[model samples]
Each structure stands twice: as structure tokens, then as C-alpha cells.
Target: MFSKSFVRRALSGLAIAGCLVVGLPTLSFADGLPGFTLWGGVKGEDSLNFRLDFGGRAGSWDRYRLRIPAKKMKLAVEQFAISYPDYYKGEFDTKNVEVIVKDKSIKLQEVRWNKDNHLLEIYPEEPIPAGSGVEIQLANVRNPSFGGMFYFNCQVLSPGDVPLLRYLGTWVITIS
Candidate 1:
């Protein structure tokens, strides 16, 4: 028979191994977002916040809540543009696009989804006031067929400004 101390040590070792086997998989995100990026030199300030209403799986229909912080909205934006990389082949619901401010939906003048240019342009009926946080809600987004990281850069065009697109931030979206 094993000594009592040896039995206790074996039990503890088994418990540790059991915990690792059960807990390690839970740490992995289904959408492939890591807790921290070690290699990508993306600054925290440049990355925008976003949410996937549905679990962002490949080829799934999802809703995206792309947010613009109040600090970034220093000027009244006449239009907002989201440009993704050419490699991303997701389809957007241009007709159902919305611009939300303070939980109220702003009337959109137009929503343009330019697949060839990889741009989604959203023009509000009126300029979104300065200092108000904005949320671009894409109601019916078709996720890409492949799982990968897509950087969706956000830009804003201010009312009465020289036709220039101001860089707001980037949304690092992940599809599983």
C-alpha cells in the first residue's frame, strides 16, 4: 500500500491536472480575440470598441455595434465612413444601417455599401452634434466565410469642413 503522504501528494497532483484540463479550454474565446496581443503593435488608444450581437462565427448573420467615443467626436460629423481591408468579403445591410446617439436612433440621409471600395458610408440627415458618443449599428451583417481578424477603420467628415476624412479609430473585429 502507498504511504499516506504519497497518496495525498498524488491526489493533489491529479487535482491540479484535472483543473488545467477543464479550465484551459474555457479561457479560449470563440471569436478568436486574445486577452492581450503580444506581436501586433496596435496602441490601445487607436483601437475602437465594438460588439457582435450574435456570436461572430464565420458565415453567420450578425449585428455589429461600432462605437465612437465622445472624446473622439469633437466635431459635428456630417458623415461617417467605415473602411475594411480588401480581404474582408463580408456583406452589410445598407438599408438597415443606423446611427444611434444617446440611445436614440438618428435619421440617416443615406447608407452606402461600396463593396468594390470596401467602404460603408453612413450619412445622417443632420450633423451629429459634437461631444456626443455615436454608435453605428449594422443590423444584418453577413460575416466573412473565413475566420480571421479584420480591421475596420472609422473616419468622420465634419460639416462645412474641407472635404477631408478625419481618422477616428479602428475596430479590430474577429470572426470565428
Candidate 2:
């Protein structure tokens, strides 16, 4: 038979343990660079507006939620831009864009582009955890047309620790 005080202490301990278990990961991840940006857009040359929602109430380590509005365009897309600062003048290869969700590789199928719009469609190869986010790395981005362009149309997903030259690109997200 346990006393009232014992029960209360047990409950308090359980609550604290639960909080630590839940909060530790968020804190650990909080220290690392923020994840990728999530943009929204349509297929054709039409413009789409979207919103980015950072989950945390205040401070850093906030998670972002993207709001992609409905559109009457051919395809809804989210775009990001990668640019180098003035000092670093070099060309980047536009062919190396990889999307990683929670360390799992995601396949980005290249969509037929119209002029400068290098489009990619995101189909999650594996099931993504509910609250987990992704990282978008544009490796070898050293092309003439690859830097300093205003990559809009989608929501900016992650707020990185360093000033990322890449605009996190856009997600070819569907808005139905």
C-alpha cells in the first residue's frame, strides 16, 4: 500500500521524466542547423502565394509549417534559389539536388522545365514521420544561371543557423 505522498511523488517524477524524454530531442536538434525551406507554387508560369509557420512559440529551434493556397494553375510548385555572396564567384552544377527527410533519401523527379525554371517533383520514397522535417542540399551549384535568383512561390521551411545562399528551393506541392 502506497501513501498519498508517495503517489504524488511518483506522478511528479513521471511527469518530469516524460518531459525530459520529449524535450531532449527537440533541444538537441535545436542546436544543429535548421532544416530546409518549404515553398509552394503551380505547374505553369502562374504565381502562387503561400505562408510559412514556425512551430515554436518563441526563440530559435522553431519548426515551420507551410501553407500552400489553392490555385487554378497547371501545377502547384514551391521554389528556392541558391546564390553565392559577392566574394565567391564560381559556377555551380544545377544537376545535383538531393532531398533528405530525416536522413532517409527522397527521390526528386526532374520535371520538364520551361526556360530557367529547373523544376523537380518531390515524391517521398519512404514514409516520413509525422513531425519530422527534411533537408535539401544543392550540391555543386556552380552554374551561371544558378545563383542569386529570387526563388519564390513556396514557403521557406527551415531557418538555418548560417545565412544559406540557397533559397531552399520550392516544393512542387499540390494544392487541391
Instruction: Estimate every model's Cα lDDT from 0 to 1.
Output: 0.88, 0.37
Per-residue lDDT of candidate 2, residues 49-145 (tens digit): 3222322222222222222222221231233332223432333333555555546666654422223433333333333333445455444433232
Q: What value does the lDDT take at residue 55 in candidate 1?
A: 76
List, residue by residue over 73-163, the lDDT tens digit for candidate 1.
9999999989999999889989989899999999999999888899999999999999999989998899999988888999999999999
Report the lDDT of model 1 for residue 129. Answer: 96
* Clash number for each model: 0, 31
Candidate 2: global Cα-lDDT?
Answer: 0.37
User: Per-residue error at 139 for model 1, in Å?
Assistant: 1.0
- Lowest summed lDDT across 10 adjacent residues in model 2 is found at 55-64
